[model samples]
Target: GDSDRLKVGELVASLSYPFGRESSLSFGIISRRGRSRSVSAGFDFIQTNAGASAGSSGGPLVNIKGETVGMVTMASQNGTMGFAIPISVIKNLLPRLERGEKIVWGWLGVRVSELTLEAADKLGLSPAKGVFVNSVVAGQPAEKGNILPHDVIVAVNGVEIDNPREFTRMISGAEAGSEVRLTIFRQGGLLQRSVILAPRPQESGGGREG
Candidate 1:
């Protein structure tokens, strides 16, 4: 499990203490920075290629500067890839645990799809990059923010989104209650708007309210 430490670019190191002697070492950049798979009580994880092994459980996954980032929870079967819970996830839950706060994953209420080259061209996206809005939940932040169906989203918080996944990734990474700026290409022109972020609601829950 990650210490849930969400350091944007924190440097750290990983130390493995196996029952036997000798420690292994590997390094790579943090890939896919964002929130955890779940909202309520989870931390975003760091995707890495660090060599982690059995008996390395509860070990320290650090950054380049030796800061603790996470632990070795699981690894790829072929031993080619690895992942760790972000340190921030641990930090957030730690405080809440001490305070006895119960949390649940939430949703922001929007449906989106990847902008394929065809879709992008149809939407008038020059280089065929951006997220396409499929639908907006009624009364949700997206709807309230005036993000309508068929809008092509190209950027969030000044970060360009080349795919629908990137759009969700950017939004999920934002702090709740923060106003997120968006660059949307609608019908025929480029428009900018800000949407306040909220907890993401579960998809299974239906009938979106604006």
Candidate 2:
């Protein structure tokens, strides 16, 4: 199945060996689409109500026609919700893995969160948009480029962004060592910064890149 064509409310099934038992199938609908949570890296996830357990990671999430649409990756602690990595993500990674090439994710070295209406008002932004920089890692590209905490990143390379996930995806898509322009709003002023991205470290500290 074309995962891109998947829609919310579509019925799907997750196949996995929960608790080391024999292969099991759980049914549910796609609860949400294109969710990028803090815990997962790279691609956004397909949120589902399907039952997934500890042993369900890496199992196939199929549609009504038995076509693999996603791969079960994680679940909520109470087992009420599940998240699946879209098959499109696997499709992109498979070629690299097969060729024995290392998957290099670009890093900006800054933690960011969604900009709230209150924060936007405080920042004097007419529209409540852009991601708010929570912190900048010392000696990293963002810090080196003078990105400070509380700064609001309005755009990347002139492309306006509205959320941390969008910003993260844009940064990760760029090649390492490439310089990208950031449009920022700070202290009721606008500015731009050119920062050279670095390779993402093996262990990330928090959400929204870096």
How do the predictions measure up, each by TM-score?
A: 0.61, 0.73
RMSD of 1: 6.8
Ten contiguous residues with the weakest lDDT in model 1:
201-210
Per-residue lDDT of model 2, residues 1-210, tens digit only: 668888999999999987777998889999876543221133456878885567778789999999999888778677878888777777777877899977676789999999999999988997877899998989899998999999999987777887886687667756567778899999999999998888888787344874
Minimal lDDT window, size 10, model 2? 34-43
Candidate 2: residue pairs that collide: none
Candidate 1 yields a Cα-based lDDT of 0.62
TM-score for candidate 2, residues paired by index: 0.73
